[model samples]
Target: MEGSAVRHFTPFWFSVEPVDTLAVRGAPALLNCSAHSDTPARVDWKKDGTFLNLASDDRRQLLPDGSLLITSVVHSKHNKPDEGVYQCEASIESLGTISSRTARLTVADGDGGSPGGWLRAVPLAIGRAPALHLCTPASVEGSHAVERWLFSH
Candidate 1:
């Protein structure tokens, strides 16, 4: 062969894979949001639709696997807004942006051993498929990516 050509391309996509997390009140908690991408991507954590300030807070830290970890879960009589829905947003140049599944963080009043408590309050679902959100650019300029929701039951 006189001349041969070989080409390689990186797949631009974002994937957040983390199951629902449960934590006891007044204990340590870890909110996971691991993202995978063929290229570099920015991962941001959000709680209750508000962006979490991981850089300024000492209690909050972004793990090496792109997951957010809360040092100590706080639940008091005065304020207990820390327990809520948490999600992670990952964005890439070619992949656009994608939001992870909403994870409900329920703080139990005790060690989760009492009957009819937080454990029992939560419902269990069978034969549920995982969700994946994706945003692909149309022209990379002045274009909005259309979203398509896919579900299997």
Candidate 2:
């Protein structure tokens, strides 16, 4: 043994994934992304701008060199006319192609409650100062009705 010592390696980041906004319309939603290679890779998918050709369409499966499998995501009826923008592009040619920052599938314009649908819940499902009726001794207007805050809880 002639003293064996060797330590020199560098790698801050080689893989990073986080692009799949949200979707919920006709069910069936799976939009995941992953990338980062060294020797094996072949993930390339696109949408919105259009460029997603899974050979034809056998489920668009591929989970070896990371992920990016989005199959069956039908959501486009709110306002119609093509609806909002939905994009997802990811390529891998030896650490190249990185276009994934647009994921938005919002199709909410039917079952939101009923009759005007609560105005479509502002700020993402009700946020404009909800919950009313308060009391503190300054209760001199309807005597703080509504069963005292619905039985105090």
Candidate with top lDDT is 1
Q: Across residues 1-153, which tens digit of lDDT does each residue of candidate 1 receive?
A: 358755457554334554565555555566656667677778888888999988898777888767777776677667785688888888786557878888877665654344422221212243322232223334254465454433322
Q: In angstroms, how far off is 29's CA in candidate 1? A: 1.1
Which digits, one per residue and each the tens of the lDDT, describe model 2 over residues 1-153? 369866444222225443433333332333445554444445555556676666677645545544444454444444342234444444544344556555544433334432322212111213212121222233346655232321110
Model 2 CA deviation exceeding 4 Å by range: 12-15, 24-32, 35-60, 63-65, 73-153
Q: What is the lDDT of residue 75 in candidate 1?
A: 72
> Global lDDT for candidate 1?
0.61
Cα lDDT of candidate 2 equals 0.41
lDDT at position 1, candidate 2:
36
Off by over 4 Å in 1: 1-16, 111-113, 116-153
Query: Local distance difference test, per candidate?
Result: 0.61, 0.41
